[model samples]
Target: MKLSDFKEGALGGVPIALGYLSVSFAYGIMAAGGGIDPLSAVLISMTNLTSAGQLAGTQLIIDGATYFQIAVTTLVINLRYMLMSLSLSQRIDPKMSTGERLLVSYGITDEIFAVAYQREKAPNTPYMLGLISLPYVGWTLGTLLGATAGNILPERLCSALGIAIYGMFVAIVIPQCRKSHPCLVVVAVAAALSCLLKYVPVLSSVPTGWAIIICTVAASVLGAVLYPEEVDEV
Candidate 1:
């Protein structure tokens, strides 16, 4: 929790924040276009920092979805947070207060989790706090500005930027998958199942949120069972 540790964490986190800021800008424009208020857009980016869940939730809102549907969809889309939280909890100081844990949890995201987990030594509480704060600030500010200027952007340009966030997701996930056979299998299975669900008669009407949950869970479980971590030969 020392000042030097906090500065180091911020330095470590700068690259991640820069990448996230760009993706979040697109999310802000989408949220605004979907009728979310500017403040709400900023809040979502600041609190959730989850592009897919935010996009799904915002579209559901624009479609006049029931409150229950929005809640369920968001939970399904964000289920991975549970795993990330569990991993991060292990890295945090054992003496850390529950309140500190709760506050840091708000900033958990794929990129943040990856960087934190990869660190050789666990980050101190102050460092984690600073790491979270910098990106959260960028996300909030980007969302506020994007929402305010959403209408002024040309439609084609906005659409292209919107696609960039998904590209970022692919860029992160694909490299990790390439390095692990089990991960590759899981991704392939999920893609196949998703495609089938989209084209099959009865499943075609299933809620996309539910379909994604089912596919992801099934694939991950299969991957874990079929490809348990390799052990070196004696």
Candidate 2:
């Protein structure tokens, strides 16, 4: 709650919030395209919070998928968060209660995980809490506002801003690429593999769902094997 803590959270969250807003705006339009109500889109953004999972779940809903399919799909897309939460567990004060951890887990995302992992000082609980709060609010509100203001905005502008999310991803990736040759190799290999999947005939039909799983698992394994963390770095 301190101003200093809030400032840090805001600084950490600004890039994430901007990226989230653009991506969520796209999601809003996609939800509308699928004939979902604006309120439902907002609810999806707030509750699911994971962009890939929500889009997958929405597609499932549009397809009239069975409950089992939807449930499995959601779990598959979000399973990475389990790993993220575990990594973050070691970073938190051990004295924090189960309930507090559960609450914080709701805001766990890749950007938040990256920021938390890089912290040199033990994060104040309030600052960590703030890290999630403002970004979550921005994500939810941006989706809702985008949906409510649907297509009234120019199409070209929306399409251009959509690139901002990808740009944000590149911003994260480029720094790590500079830090190590292995990181650059991992990204290059992943991008090449993705292109093959996108272009090649038989593999082209692979759903976005499975593509993410393949890319994430392959890249994580490759990264660990090629660039194992040094024990003394801690």
Candidate 3:
């Protein structure tokens, strides 16, 4: 929890914060397009650090989905965070108090988790806090800007900006896909499943929430089965 450690962590988070800003801008635009007010959209980004969950939830809200439907859909989409949290529990400094751990857990997004996990030693409270701080601000600020822009900008411009989110996703996935066959296979399977759900007659009727769940589970299982890891010899 030293000042130096905290500063270093913040430095490490700069790139991630920049990335979040771009992605969350798209989220804000989408939320506004779905009829959510700027303030409410900003609040959503502040509270929920999840891109997919927030976008899906916003769509459900626009569609007039029931409370149960929204709850289940969000839960299913965010189920991976539970596993991420569990993995992170083992990496945080042992001296981190229960309260600090609880606070840090609030900011455990995929990017944050990856950065925290890469440290040579366990991350302490101040480091974790610093790491999460800028990205949190960037995400919220971007959402605010995008939401406001959605109100002021012409419909055509907003529509164009909407594609930024998908572009960001591709930028994230392509490098990993290039390096790992398993990642490539999984991405392909997931994309195919998504397209099928969108185009197939009977399957096209399936809800968006359910389609995501099915694609994620199916792709993960297939990857694990096809690319079982090799054990190292002692």
Top-TM-score structure, candidate number = 3
What lDDT does each candidate get? 0.79, 0.76, 0.85
Give the candidate number with the greatest lDDT: 3
The ten-residue window of minimal lDDT in model 1 covers 225-234
Candidate 2 lDDT tens digits, 28-128: 87777678889999999999887778877987787677777678778876886888888778887677677877777888898777786787766556667
Off by over 4 Å in 2: 1-19, 52-80, 114-121, 222-234
Candidate 1 backbone clash number: 0
Clashing pairs in 2: none
lDDT by residue (1-234, candidate 1, tens digit) is: 599778877877788778767777888888888888888888777666787888778777787877887888889778878888887888877788888887778888877787777777776678787787777777777788678876688998888888877898799679868777677788899999999889999987876666777788888788778876641210
Error of 3 at 158 (Å): 2.0
Look at candidate 3 and tell me the lDDT of residue 118.
86
- In model 1, residue pairs whose N, Cα or C atoms come closer than 3 Å (at least 3 residues apart or on different chains), thus clashing, are none
lDDT of 3 by residue, 1-234 (tens): 489889988998999899889888888988887889999998889889887788888888887888887888888778878877888888889888899988999998878888998898789988888899999999999999898876688778788889888887788689888878788999999999999998999999988777877888899789888886721110
What is the lDDT for 220 in model 1? Answer: 76
